[model samples]
Target: MSYLQKPSYYTISLVVVLLLPFTILFASFLLPFSAYLRGPPPIAAGSVVAGGCSHGAADGGGGGGGGGGVRPEISILVGVHTMAKKHSRRHLVRMAYAVQQTAALRGAARVDVRFALCARPMPPEHRAFVALEARAYGDVMLIDCDESPDKGKTGSSAEDVTTGTWLNMGNKAKNRVNIFPRMYDFKGVKPEDFLEDTIGVHQLKQDLRWAQTLEHFNVTWLDPSSKMTNSLLS
Candidate 1:
């Protein structure tokens, strides 16, 4: 018998043309199905996120036997009643409070120190300086009053009300006052009256006295590499 006849060129071309569309279709379906079998891509490392428990659960002692319970936060607002003319004093006072804001203390207590001023008449330069200071510090309040301390500028509770409105202290938490804990350098206060646990030292009208007070309280001196330094003491 003779060898099988070789396929003709026209027959081979016809076979390729008929199978072209089916091959393309099969490849399209197979590509996506293969990807599906491989499963969804992983989330980016930076895109991952987590959440914490609610304040109610945190404060109510959280779930049983969880030693990593959240610490209850204490919010304190220390309003320093000062005149608009005291710009340098304000800077010093800001440093005095800012330096004391240790990380450990900040983790537990949210202490907001604000300077309260009166809407009294002042020079244009003074007003501009006050505006600049307020913008820079974001902790100054101008109360609607124009009178000296003797004329009852601070004797009324208007400042307190204004402060409450400014701070949005309308929450349900019951407020308590502790004016005694703060150090007031009035004539009645003596050296022996200084307490190690005093919250603050008021009436520090003199820079030398302020430096001394801060030095006394910051007995545990700040770290050598610390950026926060008491310029007054320096």
Candidate 2:
């Protein structure tokens, strides 16, 4: 009777082997269920509202009662220095084309991208290129130092090349103080509230520092390199 009552070690081991897989499977299913039940109720309101807002704009219906409608307009200003010459013009034109194409692909009703050329005597070649490009896209404008009313007469002393003078002229022109900034206007559109120094390479560090000042004024500094467009799109 004692021998019969003694459970065989092999039998006990076999019983455990049969139950172990089931135990693990049960735990795998139950643990997640326990976590789901114990954790905070699904963040319903926050996630729901956020999702609604995101789709609302895409569906043309925002909280403002409009459904599946167009998004607000975005103004992009591409500022180029005269030293860039033909290269700058080509780069800017390509950028404008890309911007327009991107906007169209994104389903924007309108995307206004403009190039603001800042330099002295406005290169004749640049002006011609801009004119030709503008006819096709109407996204380029030439802003020359001579256009600034504050620019002194040609006969004056050797011409000031200081950054301060260059920036001062820009501020004045943008503010419509010395001259009316009419280089680019679309449907009575004012210039972009933000400004970017599209100068890179030549004076890399100095250009960056000058751009920093513009940033202080809440302007964005776009890299002058053509690669920037690709980076931005990516």
Candidate 3:
């Protein structure tokens, strides 16, 4: 135990010799797995699609750890026909894991997930309850569809059932989502009639508007150093 005792070297060498076999055994397994894991640098997520748009370079994750970057003015709207005293699936979407891909795919700096429920004839109590949740979560966007059919049971028009909505983009960019309402070109699908198709002309129009408005705002990465490229499209 002296300051420069050489006997300690003997002990250290012996320890190294004892551990060598185990180290070699671990490496024998680790190297092969590592090479398999490193076989190919994954294709960057920039080449992936978002909202069916063939993307080159989105401002977010660029596709690996972060995925495509974020769209500044990203608005996700889910319309519910009924609001209950208890929390509904809509609330689950806002509060939990729903609509994750919309934000993840774009790699946006800011995200606004909201609900567009009609404001007419909703029981005062229900409105108040929803208002409380909105104030708490800041995730409710009310719509005055004002159509209450059959004793105001199913309020709101067919058009308002679940309309595509938009989130105002804060900045400007050409690469903003610009893929919608193409009557002539429907994502390579030449529908005989876009208006009568499963994706109605109205929906297509809304999609076009959503894409246009979202594109107007500039999308930025909340974190600059992240390397996550591919985003989940769920």
Q: What is the C-alpha RMSD of each candidate to the true structure, in Å?
A: 17.0, 23.0, 20.1
Candidate closest to the true structure, highest lDDT: 1
Alpha-carbon lDDT of model 2: 0.43
Q: What is the lDDT of candidate 3?
A: 0.44
Q: Using alpha carbons, what is the TM-score of model 1?
A: 0.51
Q: How do the predictions measure up, each by TM-score? A: 0.51, 0.27, 0.29
lDDT of 2 by residue, 15-84 (tens): 9999999999999999999988898565433222221223223122111122235644542333333332
- Which ranking of candidates, highest TM-score first? 1, 3, 2
Rate residue 35 of model 2 by lDDT: 89
- Taking all chains together, the TM-score of candidate 3 against the true structure is 0.29
The clash numbers for all candidates, in the given order, read 0, 7, 20
Model number with the top TM-score: 1
User: Which scores greater on TM-score, model 2 or model 3?
Assistant: 3
Model 2, position 208: C-alpha lDDT score: 46
Question: Which pairs clash in model 1?
Answer: none
Off by over 4 Å in 3: 1-86, 98-109, 147-234
Residue lDDT tens for model 1, 61-166: 2111112335436766666777878888877766666656555665666565567777787778878887776555556667778747654446555665665664
Show the lowest summed lDDT stretch of 10 residues, model 1: 58-67
